[model samples]
Target chain A: MKFSINQKDLYNALNIVRRAVAKNQTLPILTGIFLKLKNNKLTLKSTDLELGIKYDLTVKAESDGAIVLPATQFLNIIRELPNEDVYLELNQDKWQLQIKCINSLFKINGYDPDEFPNLPQVEESAKFELPANKFKEMIKKVRISTSKDETQPALTGALFEVESEKVKMVSTNTYRLSFIEAPLKTSVNEKIAVIIPGTTLQELNNLLEDEGSVEVEVDSNYARFTFAGIEVISRLIEGKFPNYELVIPDESNSNFSADLSQLHGAVKRASLIAKLDANIITLEAANGLMEINSAEGSSGYAHEEVKIDLEGPDQKINIDAGYFIDVLKVLDSEEINIEMIGPLNPLVVNSQKDGDKFIYLIMPVRSQS
Target chain B: MKFSINQKDLYNALNIVRRAVAKNQTLPILTGIFLKLKNNKLTLKSTDLELGIKYDLTVKAESDGAIVLPATQFLNIIRELPNEDVYLELNQDKWQLQIKCINSLFKINGYDPDEFPNLPQVEESAKFELPANKFKEMIKKVRISTSKDETQPALTGALFEVESEKVKMVSTNTYRLSFIEAPLKTSVNEKIAVIIPGTTLQELNNLLEDEGSVEVEVDSNYARFTFAGIEVISRLIEGKFPNYELVIPDESNSNFSADLSQLHGAVKRASLIAKLDANIITLEAANGLMEINSAEGSSGYAHEEVKIDLEGPDQKINIDAGYFIDVLKVLDSEEINIEMIGPLNPLVVNSQKDGDKFIYLIMPVRSQS
Candidate 1:
C-alpha cells in the first residue's frame, strides 16, 4: 500500500484505532494496527478479540494495498513527525512498511494483514441512535460503580437498556450502585438490554464527542458503536445482569440537601484520614447542618461540617467515604439531595438534570467506633 | 502550642520542608516534620539524615510549643483546607496536634519533637553567595550525568568547587560528563571543593527562586544553602572525583554547529527505534548535513537528518542517543557548537550563556555492526 497523508490527521486516526490494540503478546498480530488503502481512503483497524476500534480518513493513494504495523512504534514515529505530508508504502514481500516525512525515514517491521482477526459484527436489525453527550453522561455515572472483580463476570460491566423513548445504564459492585436514566427517542420498537464491559465504556467516554450522535447496534454477542467517523465494537457479557431495581429504595425516613461543592470538599478532607483505616466515615444530618467525621486511626481523626437544608427527622449513616466522594464528583448540580432509611440501610444520593434522573446508593458499613 | 496562620503561607512552607522528609521507615521520627512556634515565628523542619530542609513563617501565636507531625498527613490536610486562617494547637500530653480551619477540624498523631534529628551545621567561615538562577542552571546541567550506580559513590554526585572568582560543577558516569563554570565575586580567599549528593542538588534546584542570592557554606562533612527564607543542609559525599578535565578535549579535528531544536528533535525521533536495541545511534556530519541513524533491530530502522555547518574534515561517531538527548534538553541556545577529535574520542558540546561556560561530553560507543 502506498499513501500520503497529513501527519496530524494520520496521527489522530492512529490514536483512535490504537485504543483496542491488544496489550498481551498472546497474539502478536492483535497488537498491530491493520491499514488498508482502497479508493483513495485509508481504513485503520485494531482488535484484541474482545474490543475493536476502526477509523477511516481520505488519503492520496498511489497504489491500493494492506499491511498491519506495530501500533506503538507506528504511532510514535507518526506522532514525532512534523505536521506535514507523510508518505507510507508497504513491501508485501518482506512485510515491511517504509514511512517518510520531511527529513526523517523509518522502516518498520509488520505482520501480514490476513493474520489480523476481524472485529465482531453486530446485527443492524437491533440498531438505535442516541445523543452522544447524553450517552457519555450515562456512561460516566455508571462506569465508576462497575466491579473490578473478574470472578463475577456480569458485574464487571454496566447494564445498558433502551425502551421506547428512555435509555438507562446501571452498574454495581454490591457495596455501591449507580443508576442513570435519560429520555432519548430512537427507532427501536422493542426493549433491549445489554451488559457492556467497563473498559469499553471508558474508551467510549474518551472517544465520544459532545456535538454528535452515536449509532449503536447490538446482537447476542457483540455491540457496535459509530460516532464521528469512528467505529467501536465491543463484546457483550453473556451472563445475566442482576435485578438492580429491587435494591433501589422507594421511600426514606429522612432527607437532606447540602451544597455539592462544600460536601465534596468535606468528604475529601475526611477521607485523607479515614483511608488510613477502613475508609468508613460517619455522616450525620440534623437541624440544618451536616457533620462528616472519620473514626480515629493510629494516624489521626478528621471532622468536617457543612450547612444543609434538612427535612423530616435527624439522620446518621456510616458509609465508605470513597463511594460518597465518587457520586459527589460526578454530580453537576449546586445542591446534593441525600436520603436515608436508617444507619443499617443504604445511603442514597438523588440528582436531576434536564429531566434526566441519577440515583447512587452506598451501603453502610458497621462503624468501628 | 497554639498559632493561627494563613492557609496558603503555611502550605507553602510545609511544601518546601517536606522535600527532605525520609521516604523510608528506618527511623519513624525522620518521616515527620518538626514544627516549633517560638515568639511569632513558626519553623518547619524535615530531614532524611542525608538531606534536611527548614522553612519558617510568621503566625499569630497564642502560646509557644513544639511537635513533630507526620509530613504527608499534615501536608494533605493543609492542601485541602480553604484559604483562610488555620489554628493549630498541640495536645502536649497526648502528642496529638489539633488543626482547625473554617469548618474543618483535624487531630493528627505525631512523634515527640525531641526525637527529630537536628540539621548538621556548616561553619560560617567558608560561606559565599551566588546568584540563585545561575546556580540553579549549573545544577540542572551537571545533575543529569550523575551515575545511578551505588558502588561508585563519587560518581553518584556532582563535584562542586569554587576558587578565586570561578565557580564550577562537574559530574560524570565515565561514559558521559557535564562541566559548568561561572565567574562571580565571593568572599572566600581559599579554594573550596565538595561533592554534593545528586538528590540534594535536585531539592536545591526545586527550592531556589530567580530573584534572590543563595548563601552557600561548606565544611568537611556537610554543605548548607540558605535562600528565600528556606534553609537546606546536605551531607557531602566522601570520595575523590574522577579527572574529568582530561576527558574534555581542548583541541579537535572536526567542529560543527547545528540548530539545537532541530538536532534535539532528530535525535529524539531516532532514539525511538534505537532504544529498542541498546540505544546506540550513528551520527555523521559531512557536506553541511548531519545524518542520524539507528542500527536495524528486530523492530525497525530509523534515519534522521539535520542541516549543519561543518568545519574541518567529515566526522562520524556512534554514541548512546539518550546521552546526546540529555544535553540537548538542558542547553539554552539557538545553535549548539560541537567539537570532536575523531570517532575514537569523545564528542563535546560547548555552550556559553551570560558569561558562563558549559561543556557536555558523550563518549563514543563501538558500533555493533
Candidate 2:
C-alpha cells in the first residue's frame, strides 16, 4: 500500500477500527489491522471474531494495494507522530512498511493482508433507524443491569425489541434490571428482536454521536450498526432472554419523590461503610423523610437522611447500594420518583420526566431477622 | 475528642498528612493518622517511620482529646461528605469516632493515640529558605537520576550541598547524572551537606507551590521541610555519595545548540522504535544538521533529523534514548546546548540560559562493533 495521509485523519480513523482489534488472540493476523488503498480512498478494518469495525477515509494514494500491520504498534507510532502529512510505502516481499512524517521515519514489520478474516455479514431480516443520542442513552442504562456471569449467556446481553412504532431494550442480572424505551424514527414493517452482547453495546454507545442517526440491521446471527461513516458488526447471543416485563411492579403501596443529587450524595456516603461489608443499605421512607442506614460490621456504621415528598404508606427495603448508585448516575432529571410495594418487593426507581420511559428495579436482599 | 470542623478544611488537612501514612507497614498504628484536638486547633499527623507529615487547622473544639484512625478510610469518608460543618465525638471507652456531617453520620473505629509513633525531630541543624517554585524545579531534574536499586543506599538519594554562595543538588545512578545549582539568597557562614531520599524528593516536589517559599532544615539524621500549613520530616540516607564532579566533561571537541522542542519531538519519535530493543539510539551531529537513528532490530528501524547550530568538528555517539528524553522533558529553555569530546566520552546536555545552572551527563554506550 502507498498512501500519504494527514496524521490526525489517520489517527482518527485508526482509533475507530482499533476498538475491534483482537487482544491476546491465538491467530497472529487477528492482532493486525487490515489496511487497503484504492485510488484516493483508504479502508481500515479490525476484527476479534465476535465483533468487527471498519472505517474509510480519503487520502493521497500513489498506488492501490493491501497490507496488515500490528494494530497496537502502528497506532502508537501514528499517535506520537506530529500533526503533519504522513507517507507510507509497503515492501511486498519482506512485508515491511516504511512510514515517514516530517523529520521522523519508521519501518514496521507487517503481515500479509490475505490472512486477516473478513467482517461477518448480517442478512436483511429487519432494518430500523434511531436517533444516535437516544440509542446511546438507552444503552447506557441497559448496560448496568447486564450480567457479568458467563454461565447464563442470555443475561450477558440486553434484549432489544423493535416494533413498527417504538424500540425497547431490557437487561436483568436476576438481582437488578434496567428497561428503557424510545420512539423509532424509521418504521419497520415487521417486528424484530435480538440479543446484543453487553460489550458490543458498550462500544456502540461510545462511538455514537448526538447529531446523527444510526441505521441498524439485525438478523439471526449478527447485528450491524452504521453511524458517522463507521460500521460495526457484532455477533448475537443464541439463547432465550428471560421475560423481564413480569418482574416490573404494576402498583406500589408506597411512593415518593426526592431531589436526585441529594439522594445520590446520601447513598454514596452511606456506601463508604456499606461497601466494607456486603454493600447493602436499608432505605426507610416515611411521611416527609427518607432515611438510609448501612449495616454495621467490623468497620462501623453510617446513617443518612434525605427529605422527600411521600404520598403513600411507610416503606423499608434493603438493597445493594452500588446498584442504586449506578442508576442515579445515568439519570439526568433533577428529581427521581421511587416506589415500593412492601419490604418484600423490589425498589423501583423511575425517571419523573414526561416521555422518558426509563425504569430501574433493584431486588431487596432477604433479611434473616 | 469533640469538635465541629468544616468538611473542606478537614479534607484539605487530611490530604497533607495522608502522604506519610504507611502502606502495608508491619505496625498497624503506622497506617493510621494521629489526630489531636487541643484548645481550638486540630493537629493531624502521619508517619511511616521513614517519613512523617503534620498539618494543623482551627476548628470549634468542645473538648480536648486525641486518637488514631485508618488514614485511607478517614480520607475517603471526609472526601465524600458535602461542604458543610462536620461534627466529631470520640467514645473514649471503645475508641470509636462518631462523625456527623449535614444529614450523614459515620462511626469509625480508631486506635489509642499512645500507640502511634512520634514524628522524628531534627536537632541543632543548618537552616535555609528558597523560592518554592525554584526548589521544586531543581528537585524534579535531580530526581530522575536517583537509582532505583536499593543496594547502594546513597545513590538512591540526591546529595544536597548548601554553600555560602550557592546551593547545588546532584544525583547519579552511575550510568547518568543530573547536577543542578542555584544562587543562594541568604549567605551562610558554614557549609552543610546531606543526602535526601528519593521518596522525600518526590513528596516535596508534589507539596511545593509556585507562589511561596519553603524553610528547609537539614541535620545528620533528618531533613525538615515546612511550607504553607504543611510540615514534612524525612530521614537522611546514611552513606557516602558518589563524587559526581568527576563525571562531568571539562571540554568538548564538538559543541552545538538546537531548538529544544524540535530535538525533544525528534527523540521521542525515534524512541518509539528504539524502545522496542534496548532503548539505544545513535546521534550524528555536524555542520547544521543533527541526525538520530534507532539501533535496528527485528522490530524495525527509525531515523530522525533535526537542524542545529554547530561550531566544531562532527561527532557521533550512542546513548540511552530514555535518559535523553528525561532531560528534555524537564528543560524549560527554548534552546539546549550539547557537547561531546569523542565517541568514548559522555554526552553533555547543559542548559543554555546564563542564570540557570543545570547540567545533565549521559554516558555513551560503547558499540559492540
Candidate 3:
C-alpha cells in the first residue's frame, strides 16, 4: 500500500486508537494496530479483546494494501515528526513499511495483517443521540465510585438506566454511591438497564468532543458509540446491578446546607491528617457549626470548621474523606445539602439546586476512639 | 512549650527540612523532625545518618522546649491549614501538642526530643562562596552522569576538585562523563578533592535561590552548604574517583558544529523509534550532513538528517539516545561542537562559545551489526 497523509491527521487518528492497544499482552499480534489503505482512506483498528476502537481518515492513496505495525512505536514516530505530509509505502514483500517526510525517511518492519483478530460486529437494537458534553459530565460524576475490586465484577461497571425521555447513570462500591441524570431523546417504551464497565465508559467519555454530539447504539450484549469518524465497541458486563434507589435514604431527621466550596476546602484540609488513618475524617454538626477533624498520634491532627444553616439535631459521623471529596468535586453546585440520620448510618449529599435527581450517599465508618 | 506562628512561615520552614527526612528508615526517630523552640526562634532539623538539614525561623515563643514530630504529617498539616496565625502549646504530659487557629483545634502525639539522633558538626577547613545560579547550573550539567549503582559508591557522588584558582566538578557512570569548571575566589595552597553524594547536592540545589549566593564549606570527611536560612551537611563518599580526565579525547580528526536546538529536535524525534531498541541510535556524518537512524523489527525505524559545517573525515557512531539527550539538555549552549576521534572512540561535546566552561564525553556503543 502507498499513501500520503498530513502528519497531524495521522497523529490524531492514531492517538484515539492507541488507547485500546494493550501495553503488554500475552499475544504479540494484539499489541499491533491494523492499518488498511483503500479507496483514498486509511483505517486504523486496535483492540484488547474486551473493547475495540477504529479510526478512519482520508488520505491520498497511490495503491491499496494492509499491514499491522507496533501501535506504540508507530504512534510515537508520527507524534514526533514535524507537521507536514507523510508518505507511507508498503515494500514488495509486504513485510516492510517506508515512511518519508520532508528531509526524513524511515523503514519499519510490519507484521502480517492477516494475523490480527477480526473486530466484533456491532448490531444496533436501540440507537440514541445525546449531547457529548452532557454525557461526559454524567459519566465523570458517577464513574469514580465504581468498585476497583475485580472479585465483585458487577460493581466494577456503571449501571445505565434508560427511560423514554431521561437516562440515569449510577455507580457504587458498597461504601459510596453516585447517581447522575440527564435528559435524553429516545423512543424506547420499556426500561433498559445495563451494567457497562467503568473503564469503557471512561474511554468513551474521553473520545467524545465537547462541541459535538455522540450517537450510542446498545444491544443485549454489546454497546457501540460512533463519533468523528471513530467507533468504539465494548462488551456489557453480565450481572445484575443492585437497586441503588432502595439504598438512598428517603428522609432524614437532620438536614444542613453549606457553601460547597467552603465545605470542600474544609474536607480537603482535614484529609491531610485523615489520610494517615485509613482516610477517615469525622464531621461534627452542633450549634449551627460543622467541624471536620482527623487525628493520628505522633503524625499530626487537622481540624477545620464551617458555619452552616441547619434544621437538624446535633450529630457526629466518621466517613471516608476520599469518597466525600469525589462527590463534592463532581457536583456542579454553589450550595450543597447534607442529610444526617444517625452516627453510623449512610449520609446523603445532594446539590441544593439539583434536588433528588442526583443524590450521593456515603456510609460512615465506626469511630476509632 | 507554647508559641504562635504564621501558617505560611511554618509551612515554608517545614518544606525545606522535609527533603532531608528519609522516607523509610529502621530507626523511628530518624523519620521525624526535631523541633526546638528557644529565644523566639523555631529550629527544625532532620537527618538520615548520611545527610542532615536544619532550618531556623523566628516565631513567638512563650516557653523554651523541644519535641520530635513526624516530618511528613506536620508538613501536610501546615500545608493545608488556612492562612492565619496558629497557636501551639504542649499538653500537661508534655508528650502531646495542641494546635489552635481560629475556631479549630487539633491535638497530635509527639516523641521525646532526646530520642532524635544528633546532627553532625561542621568543621572549619575549606570555605568558599559561589553564585547560587552558577553553582546550580554546574550541578545540573554534571549530576546526570553520576552512577546509580551502589557497587561503586564513589561513582554515586559528584567529584568536587578545588585548586588554587579553579574549581572543577565531574561525574561519570563509565559510559558518560560531564565536567564543569568555574573561577575560585578563595585560593587554596593544596588541592581539595571530595565526593559529595549526588542526592545531597540535589537537595542543596533545590534549597538555593537563583539570584543569591551560597556559602560552601568542605572538610576532610564532609561538606556543608548554607543558604536561605538553611544549613545542609553531607558525609563525603570515601573512595578514589576514576581518572575521567584521561578518557576525554584531547584532539579529534573529525569535527562538526550544529545548532543546539535543531540537533536536539532531530535526536529526540529519532529517539522515539530508537527507544524501542534499548535506546540505541546511530549517527552518520558524511559530506556536510548528519543522519540519525534507529530501527527495531515490528516496531519501526526513524531517520532524520541535519545540515552541519564539518571539516574532518566521515564517521559513523552508535550511542544511547537518552544519554546524548541528557548531555544536550544540561549544556544550555546555543551552539554545540561535536568532535570525534574515530567511530569507536569517545565523542566529546562542548560549547562553541567561550563564557561557559563545560564538556560532555559520551562513549560510543559497539553496534551489533
Candidate 4:
C-alpha cells in the first residue's frame, strides 16, 4: 500500500482501532492492525477474536494494497511525528511497512495482510439506531455492576433489551445490580435481548460521542455497534442471563432524600476506615437525620451524619461502602433518593432525568450484632 | 491533646512529613507520624530510620500532649475533611485520637509518643544557605544520572560539594554523568562534600519552593535541609565517589550545535526503534547536518536527520539513545552544544545559564560491526 495522509488523522484512527488489539500472544497476527487502502479510502481494523474495531479515513492513494503492522509500535511512531503529511508504503516481498514524515523515516516488519482474521459479522437486518449520549450513559451505569467472576460468563456482561419504542440495560453480580431504561424510537418490529461482554461495553462507552446516534445490530452469536465513523463488533455471551426483575425491590416501606454531594462525601470518608475490614457500613435513618457508621476494625471507627427529608418510619441497614460509592459517582442529581423496606432487604437508589429512569440496588450484609 | 486546626493546614503538613514514613514494616511506629502539641505549636514528624521529615504549624490548643498515628490513614482522613476547623482530642487511656469536624467524627488508634524515635540533628556551626530554586534545579539534573544498582552504594547517590563561593553536584552510573555547578557566597570557611542518597534528593526536590532560601548542614553521618517551615534529615552514604573528572573529555576534535527542541524530538523518534534492540543509536556529523540511525534489529530500521552548525572535522559515535534523551529533556536552551574528540571518547553536552555551568557526558558503546 502507498498513501500520504495527515498525521493527526492517522493517529486518531489508530487510537480507535488499537483498543481491540489482542493483549495476549495466542495469535500473532491478532496483535496487529490491518491496514488497507483502495479508492482513496484507508481502512484500519483490529480484532482479538472476541472484540473488533474498524475505522476509515480518506487519503491520497498512489497504489491499492494492504499490510498488518504491530499496533503499539506503529501507533507510538505516528503519535510522535509532527502534524504534517505522513507517507506510508508497503513492501510485499519482505512484509515491511515504511513510514516517512519530514526528517524521520522508519521501516517496520509486519505480517501479511492475508493472515489477518476477518472481523465477526452481525445480522444487519436486525440493526436499529439510538441516541449516542443516552446509550453511553446506560453503559456507564450498567457496566459497573458486571461481575469480574469468569465462571459465570453471563454475569460478566450486561443484558441489553431493545423494543420498538423503548430500550433497557441490566447487569448484576448477585451482591448488587444496575437497571437503566430510556425511551428511544426505532423501526424494529420485534423485541431483541443480548448479553454484551463487559470489555465491549467499556470500549463502546469510550468510543461513543455525545452528539451523534449509534446503530446497533444483534444476532445469536455476535453484536455490532457503529457510530462516529467507527465500527465495533463484539461476540455475545452464549449463556442466559438470570431473572434480574425478581432481584430489584418492587416497593419500599420507607424513603428519604438528601443532598447528593454531602452524602457522597460522607460515604467516601466512612469507607476509609471501613475498607480496612470488609468495607461494610451501617446506615440508620430517623427524625430527619441519617447516621452512617463504619464497623470498628483494627484501624478505628468513623461516624457521619447527613440531614434527610423522611417520608415514613425509621430504618437501618448494613451494606458495602464501595457499592454505595460507585452508584453515587455515576449519579448527577442534586438530591439522592433512597428507599428501603427493612434490614434484610436491599437498599434501592433510583432516579429519573429527562424521561430516563435508573435504579441501583445494594444487597444488605448481615451484621454481626 | 485538645486542639482545633484548619483541615487544609493539617492536610498540607501531613503531606510533607509523610514522605519519610517507612514503607516496610521493620518497626510499626516508624510507619507513623509523631504528633506533639506544646506552647501552641503542633509538630508532626516521620522517620524511616534512614530519612526523616518534620513540620510545625500553630493551632488553637486547649492542652498539650503527644501521640503517634499511622501516616497513610491520618493523611487520607485529613485530606477528605472539609476546609473548616477540625477538633482533635486524645484519649490517653486507650491511646486513641478522636477527630471531629462538622458532622463527621473519627477515632484512630495510635501508638504512645514515648516509643517514637527522635529525628537526628546536624551541628548548626557548619551550616550555609543557598537559593532554593537553584538547588532544586541542580538536584533535578544530577539525580537523573544516579545508579539504580544497589551493589555500589556511592554510585547510587549524587556527590554534593560546596565551597566558600561555589556549589557543585555530580552523579554518574558509568554510562553517563551529570555535573552542575553554581556560584553563591557563603559564610563557611572550610569546604564540605557529602553523598546524598537518591531518595533524599527526590524528597528535597519535591519540598523545595522557588521563593525562599534553604539552609543546609553536612556532618559525617547526616545532612540536614531546612526551608519553608519544613526540615528534612538524611543519612549520608559512607563511601567515596568515583573520580568523575577523569571521564569528562577535556578537549574535542569536532564541536557542533543544533536547535535543542528539534534535536530532542528527532532523537526521541529515532529511539522508538532503537529501544527494541539495545537502545543504541549511531550519530554522524558532517556537511553542516547530523544523521541518526538505529541498528536494524528484529523490528526494523529508523533514520533521522537534524540540521546543525559544525566546526572542525567530522565525527561519529554509537551511544545509548536513552542516556542522550535524558540530558536533552533537562536542558532548557535554544541550542544544544556538543563536543566530541573521537568515536572512542565520550560525547559532551554542556550549557551555561545565569553564570551556572552544566555538563553531561555520555560514554560511547562499541559498535559490533
Candidate 5:
C-alpha cells in the first residue's frame, strides 16, 4: 500500500481509534491498529473485545493494501514529526511498513491484518441524533454518581430511559443519585431502559465535538455513536436498573435558596476539617441562617454560616460535604434550591432558575448523638 | 491564645513551612506545625528530623500561646477561607484552635507545642548571600542529575563547593554529571564542600523569590537559608563524596556543534522507537552530517539525519537518548558543542559561546556487538 496524507488529519483520526487499543492485551495482535488503504481512502480500526472504534480518512493512494502496526508507537511518531505531508508504503510481503516525513524515515514491523477482529455491523434500530454539546452536558451532570464498585454491576453504568417525548439519564451509587432530562426527537410507544457503562459514556462524551451534533443508534445489546468520521460501539450491561424516580422526594418540609458559589465555598472550607472521616459535614438551618461545621480532634473544627431564604421550620442535616460540592460544581448555576424532608432523609438539590432540567439527590448521614 | 491576621499572609507563611512536614512520619508530632503566637507575631515551624523550616508573620495578638496543629489540614483551611481577616482563639486547655472569618468559624484540635521537635540552631559560621534568581537558576540546572538511589546517600545530594571568589555546584549519579559555577562575594579564605540533600535543595529552590538576594549560612554539618521571612535548615549528608572532577573528560579529539533545539528535536524523534532496554540510540557523524537511529525487532526502527559542523574525523557513538535529552534541556545556550574523545568514552557538552562555565558529561553505552 502507498499513500500520502496531511500529518494533522491522520493524527486526529488515529487518536480517536487509539483509545480502544489496550496497552497489554493478552492477544498480541490487539495492540496493533488495523489499517486498510482502498480506493483513495484509509481506514483505521482498533478494539479491546469489549469496545471498538473505527475511523476513516481520505488520502492520495497510489496502491491498495493493508497492514497492522503498533498503535501507540506509530501515534507518538506521527505526533512528533514536523508538520508536513506523511508518506506511508507497504512492502510486497506486507511484513514491513515505512512512514516518512521530511528527512525522517520510520520502518516498523507489521502483523498480519487478517488477525484483526471484524468491525461490528449496526443494524437498523432505534436511532436518533442530538446536539453534541447538549448530550455532553447531560452526561457530565450525571456520570459522576455512577457506582465505582463492581459488586453492583448494574449500578456501575448510567441508565438511559427513552420515551416518546423525553429521554432521561440517571446514575446512582446508592448514596447519591443524579437525574437529567432532555427533549428527544424519536417517538416510541414502549419505554426502553439500558445500562451503559459509565466509562464508555465518558469516552464517547470526550470524542463528541462541542459545536456539532452526533448520531446515536441503539439496539437491544449495543449502542453506536457516529461523528467526525469515527464510530464507537459499546456493549450494554445485561441487568435490571433500579427505578430511580421513586427515590426522588416530591415534597419537602424545609426548603431554602442560596447562591451556588456561596454554598460551595462554605462546603469546601468545612471539608478541610471533615476530610478526616469520610468528609462528613453537618449543616444546621435555623432562623434563616445555615451553619456548616466539621470537628476533628487536633485538626480543629470549621463552621461557616450562610444566610438563606427559608420557607419551612428549622432543621439540621449531616451529609458528605464532598458530594454536595460535586453536584453544585456540575450544576453550573447562579443559585440553587435545597429541599429537605427531615434530618435523616435524602436532600433534593436543583437550580432555582427556570430552563434547567437537572436534579441531584443526596442521602444525609445520621449524626452520632 | 488569641490573634487576627490576613488570610493571604497566614496562608503564605504556612505554605513555606509545610514542605518540612512529612506526610507519614513515625512520630505523630512531625506531621504538625508548631504555631507560636507571641509579641504580635505568629510563628509556624515544621520539622522532619533531617530538615526544619520556620516562618513568621505579623498579626494582631490579644494573648500569647503556642500549639501544634496538623500541617496539611491547617493549610487547606486557610486556603479555602475567603480573603479576609481571620480571628483565632485557643480554648479548653489550649487544645482547640477556633478560627473565625466573616461568618465562618473553624475549630481544629491542637497538640501540645512542647511535643514538637526543637528548631536547629543558627550558628555563627560562614555567611554569604547571592542573587535569588541566579541561585535558583544554578540549582535548576544541576539538580535533575542528582542521584535518586539511596545506596550511596552522599550522591543523593548536590555538592556545594564554596570559595572566596566563586560558588560551584556539582551533581552526578555515575552515569551523567553536571557542574555550574557563579561568582560570589565572601572573605573566608577556607573552602567548604557540603552535600545538601536533593529534597532540601528542591524545596529551598521553590521558595526562593525573583530579583532579590537570599542570605545563606553554612556550618560544619548544616546549611541555613533565610529568604522571604522564612528560614530553612537542612543537615548535610555525612560521607565522602566521589571525586567527580576525575570523571569529567578534559580533552577531546572530535568536536561537533549544532542548534540545541534542532538536535533535541531529532533525538526525541529517534527515541520514539527505542524502548526501555537501555533506550540506546546510535549517533553517527561523517562528512558534516549526523544520523540518529534506533531499532527494535517487530516494533520499528527510526532514522533521522541533521547537518552539523564537525571539526574532527568521523565517529560513531551509542548513548541513552533519554539521558542526553535531560542534559540538553538544562543548557541555557541556543547552540551546544559536543566534544567526543573516543567511540566508547565520556563526552563533554557545553555552550559554544565563550565565558559559559556550565558543562555536562554523559558516558556512552558500549554496544553489545
Candidate 6:
C-alpha cells in the first residue's frame, strides 16, 4: 500500500486513537495501530479488548493495503516530522512500513494486520445525541467519585441513566457520590441505563470536542460514541451501579454559602497538613464565618477561615479533604452552597446558577481514635 | 522567632536553597531548610554534604531566633498561600513554626536549628567576577558532557579554569568532551582551577539571573558562587582532568558546514531508529550533501539527507547519536561547522559567532559487526 497525507492530519488522528492502545502484554498486536488505506481514505484503529477507537481521514492513495505498526514509535516519528506531506508505503512480504517526510525516511517493523483484533460490534438499541460540552462536563463531575478498587467492579464505573426527557450520570465509592442531571429534549419512549468504566469516561473526556454533538449507541455489552469523525467503542461493565439518590440528603437543618475561590484556597492549604494522616479536615460553619482545620498531631496543624452567609443552624463535620477539593476544581461558579444536618450527616454541595441539577455528597468520617 | 515577609520573597528564597536539600536517605536534618531570623534579615540555608546554598531576604522582624523546617512542606505551604504578608512565629520548646498567610494558618514541625549542619567556608585565595548570563551559558554548554557514572568521581564534574583574561569550563565522559571559554576582564594574580560537581553547576545554572554578575571564589578543596542574594558552596572533586586539547584536531582533511536546524532535525529523526541498539549513526559527507543513516536491524532503518558546503575531501564516520544530539541542543548558531580528520579521529565542532571560543569533540564509535 502507498499513500501520502499531511503530517498534522496523521499526527492528530494518531493521538485520538492512541488512548485505546493496549498497555498490557496480553496481546502484542493490541499494542499496534492498525492502518488501512482503501478508496482514497485512510482508517486508523486501536483497541485494548475493552476499549477501541477509530479515526478516518482522506489521503492521496496510490494503492490499497493494511498493516499494524507499533503505536508509540509510529506516533513519535510522525509527531517529529515537519509539517509537510508524509508518504507511506507498505512492503507486504516483509511486513515493514516505510514513512518519508521531507528529508526523513524510515522503515519501521510491524505486525501482520490480520492479527489485530477488530473493534466490538455495538448494537443501537437505545441511541441519542447530546451536546459534547454538557456530556463532557457530566463525565468530569461523576468520574472523580468512581472508586479505583478493581474488586468492586460496579464502583469503578459511572452509571449513565436516560429517561424520556432527561439524562443523569451518577457514581459513588460509598464515601462520596456525584450526581448530575441534564435536560434532553428527544423522542425516546424507553429508559436506558448503562455502567461505563471510569477510565473510558476519562478517555472520552480527553477526545470530545466542545463544538459538536456526540452520538451514543449502546447495547447490553458494548457502547459506541461518535463525534467529529472519531468513534469510540467501550465495553460496558456488567454490574449494578449503586443507587446514588438514596444516599443524597433530601433536606438539611443548616445551609451555608461562601465565595468559591476563597473556600477552594482555604481547603487546599488545610489539605497540605491534613494529608499527613487520613486527609480528614473539620469544617465548622456558624454565625457569619466557616472554619476549616486539619488535625494537629505530632506533625502540625492548619486552620483556615472564610466568611459565609449561614441559614437555619450551626454545623460541624469532618470530611475527606480530597473529595471536597475535587468538586471545587470541577466547579466554575463564583459561590458554592453547602447543606449539613449534623456532624453525622453527609455534607451536600449543590451547583448554583446555570442549573441542571448537580449535587455532590460527602460522607463524614468518624473521628479517629 | 516572629517575623512577617512577602509571600513571593519567601518563595523565591526557598527555591534557591531547596536545591541543596538531600534527595536520598541521608541525615534527616539535611532534608530540612535552616531558617534564621536576625537583625531584620531572614536567611535560608540547606546542605546535602556535597553542595550547600544560602539565600537571604529582608522581613519585619518581631524577634530573633533560628529553626529548620521540613523543606518540601514549608515550600509547598508558602507556594500555595496568597501573595500577601506571611507571618512566622517559632516555638523554640517544641521546634514548631507557625505560619499565617491571609486567612490560612499553619504550624509545621521542624528540626532544632542546632542539629542542622553549617555550610562550609572557602578561603578567598583566588576570586573573580563574570557576567551571570555568560557563566550560566557556559555551564549549560559544558555540564551536559559530565558523566553520570559514579565510578569516575572526577569525570562527574566540570573543571573551572580562570586565568587573568580568560575563563574556561571543560567537561567530558571520555567519549565526548565540551570546552567553552569566555573573555574575562578581572584582577587575578594567580590562575585557579577547580572541578565543580555537575549537580552544582546545574543548580547554579537554574539560579543565575541574566542581569548581574556572579562572584566566584575557589580554594584547594571548595568553590563558592554568590550572586543576587544567593550563595552556593560546593566541595571540589580531587583528580586531574583529562587533556581535552589532545583530542581536538587542529587540522582536518574534511571541513563541512550546514544549516544548524536542518542537520539537527535530520540527525534527530535518524537517531530515533539507531537508538534502538547502540545509538550509533553514520555521517557520510560528499559533494554538497550529507547522508545520515541508521543501521538496519530487526527494527528497520532510517535515512536522512542534509545539504552541506564541503570545502575539503569527503569523509564518513560513525558516532553515538546521543552525544551528537547533546551538542546540537546546546548550540545557538544558524550554521554549524564540522571538521573531520579521518574515520578514526574525533569530530570537532567549532562555535560560529560572538567571538566566543567553544569546541565540542566527539570520539568515533567502532563500526558494528
What lDDT tens digits, residue by residue, belong to model 5 across residues A1-369?
A: 999998998888888899888668699788989999999989899987767898888899999999888888888889988879999999848478999988788888878898888867667678777778878888898888999999999899999887777778899999999998877665555777788888788788778878877787788788888877778888888888998889998889998988888888998888877877678888888888888878553455677899898989987888888898889788776878888989888988865323437879999887632
Q: What are the DockQ scores of the candidates, in order?
A: 0.92, 0.79, 0.61, 0.86, 0.68, 0.86
Please identify which of the two predictions, 1 or 5, would achieve the higher DockQ against the true structure: 1
Q: For residues B106-195, what per-residue lDDT tens digits would candidate 3 score against the true structure?
A: 777778998888888768778877778878888888888999999999999999998877778999999999888877555566788999
TM-score of each: 0.99, 0.98, 0.94, 0.99, 0.94, 0.98
Q: How large is the interface RMSD of each prediction?
A: 0.6, 1.1, 2.5, 0.9, 2.1, 0.9
Worst 10 residues of 3 chain A by lDDT: A350-359
In candidate 6 the C-alpha lDDT for residue A252 amounts to 88
Identify the superior model by lDDT, candidate 4 or candidate 5: 4
- Residue-level lDDT of model 4, residues A20-102, one tens digit each, is 99999999888899999998999999999999999989999999999999999999999999999999999999999999999
The list of candidate 4 runs beyond 4 A from truth reads none
Number of the top DockQ candidate: 1
Candidate 2 residue B170 Cα shift, in angstroms, is 0.7
| Candidate 3, number of clashes | 0
Q: Model 2, range B5-107, lDDT digits (tens) per residue?
A: 8999999889888888998868988999999999988999999888999998999999999999988889999999999999999998988899998898999
Q: Cα lDDT for residue B191, model 5?
A: 91
**lDDT assessment of candidate 5:** 0.84
Q: Provide the clash count, candidate 1.
A: 0
Worst 10 residues of 5 chain A by lDDT: A350-359
lDDT score of residue A240 within candidate 2: 94
Docking class for candidate 4:
high
Question: How well does candidate 1 score on lDDT at residue B258?
Answer: 97
The weakest ten consecutive residues by lDDT in model 1 chain B span B116-125
